[model samples]
Structures are given as C-alpha cells and as structure tokens.
Target: MIAKEFTNYIFKNNIIRFGEFRLKSGRLSPYFFNFGAFNSASKLSSLGEFYASTIIEKKIDFDVIFGPAYKGIPIALSTALSLNKKDYPDVPFSFNRKEIKQYGEGGQIIGSKIKGKRVLAVDDVLTSGKTIRNTKEIIESEGGILYAFLVALDREEKGLNTELSALEEAARECNVKIYSVANISNIIEYLNENYDKNHKFNKSVREYIEIHGSKK
Candidate 1:
C-alpha cells in the first residue's frame, strides 16, 4: 500500500517510463527510471524528502552526506536539507567536482570537510556501482569513512560477471549496506497484486524480470 503510492506517483509523474529503453549496458530494458523528469522545485524537494524518509526508516547512521560529481550533487543537497528538517539538523552535505581544483581556495571537495566523518553517499541509481566504488575511494582517501550508500532505485539486474546484482556487488566491495526507496522487485510485486491486470505493464515487467533479473 505505502509502496504502491511510490510506484503510482512515479508513473503519474512520468519519472519511470514503460516502453522500450536502451540502457548504457546496451540491453533493451522494458522500463526505465528517469530522474530527469523530476524537473520542478517542488518535485526535487519531494524527492529529497523521500530519500530522507528512506534513510530514517532504514536507521542508517552517518555524520556527513556526500554525493559524487554531476547527477549526485542535487541528491546530496536535497537529502541533507530534508534530513535537517526531519530531526537531523546540522548535517553537512558535500559533492566532489568533476576535476580537482588546483587554484586559490580550491580542492576537489566543495562542502563540509570529510576527514574523520562517517559519510553517506547519495545517488540516483545503481547501474554498475563503479561510480560508487570510486566515490568510496575518494572519501576514504581523505580519512572519511563511507558508512553507507543510498540510491533512488536498484534495477535488480545481475552484475556483469556474477549473479549478484550491482547493488550486491557494491555493498560487498564497499563493505557497507546500500539502501533504496523502491526497487524493481517492489514495482513488479505491487503491480501484480494491485492495479489493473488487464494493463500490460505488470505482464511486461514480469517477462523482463524472468529473462534478465537476478535474485536480490
């Protein structure tokens, strides 16, 4: 019920599209999660609140919020803001630059100092976990511990070389549990048990998972 609201909201807002989609892995996906559709200020704030609620619900602990360059920048800021509003006041957020700054008052990091802090890295999704692993290296290199990583979704597809999903590999490699608001499995279950059975969405998802998804 609570999770159904999330899937429905995503579909209603066009955040997740149901159709043929070509992923970077060169696989044709039945559905796609598009964070870019969350383009409005209100939507962004809501997204932040969702991520904060997931973090709180999971009871994941950390001292600082960090995001990798580019896509993760807003996620880190929004999560920090929402966490601040929801009993986590003074939680500092930071993001890395694409290129290290070598000039006056400059470095790679752009926000709260990370040394000695337990950092929670936030991002949109877990595709390969390569970016997350690199982020972990960056944080640990500076004396910060990467306590956990949170993504908006986990596709539940297997890793390139193993039956474990990308999230599983990332968790294993980073030695930290990864959390997500709603994964593809949740969507599939919600659709099958609820919503209109006549619609093709649930059936399509079932086929996709059967062909490509791995055990979560």
Candidate 2:
C-alpha cells in the first residue's frame, strides 16, 4: 500500500526525516518520525483524519479509543474528532496519565467509562510495546476489554528475535488483533520508488533497513 496521503503529509510537513541519529533504543537510525510536531489544531485535525481513514479502511470495530498517554492523548482526541467529523460517531475515548492521580478522575484512566467496552488502543508507534501493555493493564483494571491495537507505524524489526515485531508481541499479549497505517518496509519501498538510491540519504536508509528491519 502506498499510503499516499500519509506519506505526502509526512514528507510535506517534515514530520519524518532522513538522518544519522541515535534512537531511544540506542540504535543508529536512518529515518525518524516525530509525531510530536502535530501541535497546532490544524495539524492535529489533519493527523486525526488520516488515523480515522485508516480505522475505516481497516474496519476496526470497537466502542472506545484509548490513547496510551502523553503522545497518545492528542492522537486519540484528534482521531475521535476526525471520526466525528466524518459522521462515524462513536462515544467513549480515553487516555492514561503518566502519573496516576489520586484525585479528580482518579487513578490513571481519564475521559470515559472503560468497563465492559471493547477498546482499541491507539498510538503513533509501537516500539517496545511496554507503553501499550501498561495502558492495557490500566484499562483492564477497570474491566475494559482491550481487543485490538492501532498505530501509525510499525518498525517491523525484532524485539528479541527477528521473528517478532513489537506490534506482534503486543497483539499476542493483549489477545487482540493489531494494525498500522504504515511500516518500515512501506517507507523503504516508497523511498526506493520516489528517489534514486544515489540520493543523499536514500541508499543508506535502504541498506540499514535491509540489514535490520526484516523479521530475520
């Protein structure tokens, strides 16, 4: 899948970049996607629309959209708003707080009744799956049934062995299906088709990905 809209958005906004950088994972990465740049209302709205489109395309059925907190909060809120705009209204969206508060909403979950609902965890990326697992525990504590996870990108690299991606592990542990709008492979393919390998960062990214991205 080309994911033209998503790719174009990333490209135009400089949200995803080609570079020599160290990731939080301590790996030298060739490309980086900083979803944090979607700070303005317009950008947030646009991002939500893309996410909503992906949800619709994937035919995801769930009662609640749960963002994992911080980053996930805007993603869930924007996606919910976008879905609302498209007239695909579904009530109940919530997100976790980094620090579990003892007051106000109480505990970690905020924004909706989590119990007894089929929840979809939403986030920008699935790196180690730790965040999702923590969110799942929070929701499940309230009797929420987390049956699916949706993300923007899947790196498609191994966590421990090359046999499993973090998304795959999250799905297995959550006992739900998982999906993403795009993956590392998709980005690689897109770059290969759009620009020459001799281009500044293109060849290096392709080579790095080919070495570390596959499910070895």
Candidate 3:
C-alpha cells in the first residue's frame, strides 16, 4: 500500500525516530517525525512524489498550491514539480514570506497569484493546527478560496481542548478538508508488521496513542 511504502521510506531515511521527545505542545511523544530530514535532492524529490501521489489519490482539486513560509516552501515547489511529472503539467505553486519584501517584486506572497483561485495549502504535519489556520487567513485576505489542506502525517491526537483530532478541529474551524499521506496508526502498524512484534518502542507507541489518539 502507499501508506506502508511511505512509512517505510521515512523509516529508511531516518525521518521518523522512536524515542521520548518533547513536542511543541509540551507533551512527551514516543516518536518524532522530522520532515527536515528530507534535505537532499533525492530525498526531497521522493518526498514530493509521495505528496503528489497522495494529492492525486485523494482527488484534491485546486488551481494553486500554497505553502506556508519556511519549511513549506520547498514542499510546495517539489509537489508542483512532481505533479508536473505525473501528467499535471503547468501546476502552479505559491508561498508566503515571513516578512514583506521591500525591494524587487515587493510582495508578501511569491509565485502564482492566489486571488480568486482555489488554493490548497501543503505542510509537513498537523500539530496544534495554528499554522494551518493562519495560512487560511492569509489566503482569505488575498481573495483566495482555501479548497483544502494536505499534510505528510496526521498525529491523530486530540486538539488542545476538543475531543476532535488537530486535523479534524482545523478542518472544522477553517471549513476546509485536510488529508494526510499517512497517520500514526499506519506507522505503528507498519512497524509491528515489519519489525519485531514485541518491540518495546512499538508497545510504547501503542500506549501513547491509546492515551492521546482521537476516535477514528
């Protein structure tokens, strides 16, 4: 399956590591997904292909791809390139700047103009959902309709207050659907199937999800 393959790829590349890690939300997680590990050209190209395949598999429709500042910039560009290779030639991607450029083009947004277009925001993961909401606001302010969101992984954990997962809450609050290439469950399952069935880390991950995971 694609999810299994994607999980395997991340594991092989050491993007996902099993350990006790403090998340941005201050919760101690049993594992970590470091998207930044996909730094090399080949790794980034493969990551882009995975994201593009997910977008196509989900039938996500959008006139432009929007990536948030920093980490999202390369993802947006690579996804567009991968889509182009997958028969989606002419795919346009846009990204925002942390600070308004005062020279040259002098704009907050770079690449395609999102105004009056169906925009899909792509990112690495959904944690607090704050970033995705902020992206939505930027899109709306620019006259763009946020059609949906795409992420590499869904942690499947509850929001700060709600019983809904972060992804679910973001989709509800933003009024846009969110899709992921894989979720925590897929990773755990892949590990159990491919690695030792009684691995201590796998057991810990299962317990962690039991305590914090959202209802399917």
Question: Which candidate ranks first by lDDT, i.e. highest?
Answer: 3
Model 3 C-alpha RMSD vs. true structure (Å) is 1.2
Q: Find the number of clashing residue pairs for candidate 2.
A: 0
Best TM-score among the predictions, by candidate number: 3
> What is the C-alpha lDDT profile of model 1 across 138-191, one tens digit per residue?
998788999989888888888778889888888898898788888887788767
Candidate 1, after superposition: displacement of residue 103 in Å? 1.5
Candidates arranged by lDDT, highest first: 3, 1, 2
Measured by TM-score, how close is model 2 to the native structure?
Answer: 0.91
Structural similarity to truth (TM-score) of each candidate: 0.92, 0.91, 0.96
Per residue, candidate 2 scores C-alpha lDDT tens digits across 18-81 of: 8887765677888888887787989989888888898888899999999886788888998998
- Ranking, TM-score, top scorer first: 3, 1, 2
Candidate 3, 31-131: lDDT as tens digits: 99998799899999998999899988889999999999888899999999999998885898999999889999998899999999999999998887888
